[model samples]
Target: MSNLSGKTAIAGIGATEFSKDSGRSELQLAAESILAALTDAGLTPADVDGLVTYTMEKNPEVEVARALGMGDIKYFGRVNFGGGAPGAVVLQAAMAVATGVADVVVCYRAFNERSGRRFGAGVQDRGTEPSAENAGYAWYTPHGLVTPAQWAAMAGRRYMHDSGATTEALGAVAVAARRHAATNPKAWFYERPITLEDHAESRWIAEPLRLLDCCQESDGAQALVIVSAERARDLPQKPAIIKAAAQGISGSTAMMTAYYGDDIGHLTEMTLVADQLWADAQLTPADIPTAIIYDHFTPYVLMQLESFGFCGRGEAKDFVRDGNVELGGRLPINTHGGQLGEAYIHGMNGVAEGVRQIRGTAVNQVADVQNTVVTGGAGVPTSGLILGADR
Candidate 1:
C-alpha cells in the first residue's frame, strides 16, 4: 500500500443548499461551506494551515482565508478540469497533510453554474488563441460539438452501437438516481421520482442522451476538511479515512472530446484512475459495497462501472439492469442522488456523500458500507477516491 493510504482522513464535509439560483456570490458560498466544514470537524479557522480548490474556482485561497479570518496558511493548491477536480482537490490536501506540508487542509468548490454561467449552454466564442487548451477544442468545436452533452453523446452513441445497448440502459441510471433522491430531503429532486418511461419521453438534448440523461447544472458549493488520521480519530465526527487517491490521463487526453483516442466507446482515463485506486488502497470492487459514481452524464456512469472492473467491458448495461446499482443491491451508487437527482457542485457533493456513507450518517445509507468509491468526471483526465471507515 502507498504511504498516503490511511494517513489522512476526511474529518468533515459540508455544502450549501442546492438550487437553480444561489442568489449569492461564489465567494460567499465558498466561505459558508468552509466555515460549516470546520465546525463539523470540531475545528476553527485557527486550526487550518492549508486550502485546496479547483483551478476554475474564482475565489483565491488567500482571499477566502481572509474572508474566513483564517490565520497563517502554509500550503495552497489547485487542480484543473471541470467536474474531474473534486477528488483531485482532496488528493492535493491529503498529500499536503501526509507529507507534513500542512496540518489541516480544506478542499472546496463553489460555483453559480445555473444562474451565472451554465456549462450545458455550450461554449462561447472567446476568439482564437495560440493556447493548447483552445487547440484541443478546435478539432470539434467548429463542427457544433460544443456542449458537454453533445461531446458525451458522440461516445454514448458509439457505446450503444458497439454493445447493442439501447437508450433504456442510460435511463436506468437516471431512474436509480432519482429513486435515491426521492427520499433524500436534501436533494433537489426530493419526493420527485421518475420511471423509465419518463426518461424515455424526456426531450433529447443530443441523440441517445435525453434531458434526464444529463446531470443538473446547479448552483451550489461543497467543502471537506482533511487532516492526519491520528488527529481525525480524536475529532467528534467519525473520520472517513482516505484509503486511496488517484488521478490519471490517457492517450491524447482532451476534456470530454477524446474521440481521437483508441476507443471512443470506453473511458480509458477512468480505467487508469480505477487501476491505481484499487492498487494503492489494496482493495477491489468486491470490497466496496457502494460508490458515489460521477454522473455528469448517465452513459458515463455505465462506462465508469466497467472501467473500474465492476463488470466486463460492454457489460455495464447488463450489470446496471440487474438491480445491482440501486439500494439493497450489490453496489448502491450515488445514494445521495448524484449530480442528476441531487445538486451538481462539480462532483464535490458526491465526495461528501462518500464521506457520509463512511460515517453511517447518509440519508440513503447502505448496509455494511465499509468502503465507498468516489469518482470524478469521466471522459477527461479524471480522478477517483476510496474512503473507508477508520480501521
Candidate 2:
C-alpha cells in the first residue's frame, strides 16, 4: 500500500555462531556479522552508507562503522521495545534505501545476553533513575512480577482459561520447534529434541511456562544487507524482496506486563501488525507458505497465529495440536528451529531464516515458499515483515 513496497530487498544475510558465550566483545560480533553479510552480497565495507540497530544494543553505529572501515554513513537509526525491534531495524533501513537516503544499509543486532547479562535474572538492583518505562515497572515489581517468564505466565494462564487450552498445547509448540531444531546443525538445541512428556517433566519457570517453553539465552549477532531492488538483482544471492513491513502499539501497555488491558490473553499489538502486513502487501494468510513466528514464549506463538488470522481466535491450540505448525504440515512455522530450539538472538535469527526460506536454502526447506511472514516479539510494541520471492 506504500511506495516502499517491493522497492528494496535483503540481498544477503550473515551471522556469528549462536552460543552461550562468544568469548568476544559485542562490537566484534557486530563487525563480523556485517562483514560476512557484505561478503555474501558480493560487496565491501566501503559500500555501506547506512546502519540500523536496536536501541538496547551496546555497540554504537559509529563504532561498528569504524571497526569495519566503512564509508561516511548518511543514515543511522535505532529502534526501541526490546524484542519488538528486530523487524523495525529492517523497516528503517528499507525506508532509507527506498527514499534515496542511502544506497546500502546494514541492519544488525549483537549482544552477550547469556554470559554477560541474562535478562531472565529479572530486576536485580536498579539505580534510582526515574523514567516513564521504569515507572511502569513500579506497579508490578512489588507484586513479584519481575522476570519475563512471570509476565508471560500470567498471559498463558488467561489464554488457557479462555480457550480451554491445556498446558499440553503449549508443550506442542515447544515439541515442534525442537523437532525442527534437532536436525538444524546451527541450532543450539540440535540433536536435543524434546517430546510432550519431556516438556511436561521440565521444571516450571512459572506457573504455566516450563523450562522448555522459554527461549534460550544466547550470545551472538545477525546482520542483513539491504539495497534497492534494482541493485539487489545484480547481487550474487537471490534477494528476499520486502513486500511489506510494519510496527504497531495498540493498547496502553508496559513491556510484557499489560495485564491491565481488557484481555490479557490476546496480543492486540501483533494483531495491528498483521492487519498492516496483509493490507500493505496485498496478501492474505493463505498466500504465505511459511512463517518465522517469534517464540520468546510458547503461548505467544499461538497468540500470534490467531492475531495474524492464520486461524480463528482461540483456535491456535487446536491448530497446533493437530500438527499444523510442523514441517510438512499445513502452515509449518519456524523452520529454522525458532527461538525455543534455535538460539534466541532476540528474533533476528528468525528474520534470517525467513530469508533462507525465500531463497529455498533452509535446512528444513518448505515445498513452495514464495512468501514468508516473519514476526517480532509479542506482548510488547511489535513489528512484522512479509518477504517474497522477486516476481
**TM-score of every prediction relative to native:** 0.98, 0.98
Local accuracy of candidate 2 as per-residue lDDT tens digits, 1-391: 5667899999989999999999999999999999999999999999999999988899998899999999889999999988998888889999999999999999999999999889898874544479877777887777888898998898889988998888788988999899999999999999988889999999989988889999999999999999999999999999999999999899855589878888888898999889989998899999988899999999999899999999999999998986679998888999989999988898999999999999999999998789999999999888989999999
User: How would you encode candidate 1's per-residue C-alpha lDDT over 1-391 as one tens digit per residue?
Assistant: 4678999999988889999999999999999999999999999988999999998898899889999999989999999988898889899999999999999999999999999989998885745788988887788778888899999999899988888778888988999999999999989999999999999999989998999999999998999999999999999999999999999898866688878877787888898889989998999999999999999999899999999999999998898885678898878899999999998999999999999999999999998789989999998788999999988
- The Cα local distance difference test for each model comes to 0.91, 0.91
Model 2 scores what on Cα lDDT? Answer: 0.91
Worst 10 residues of 1 by lDDT: 121-130
Error of 1 at 234 (Å): 0.7
Off by over 4 Å in 1: none
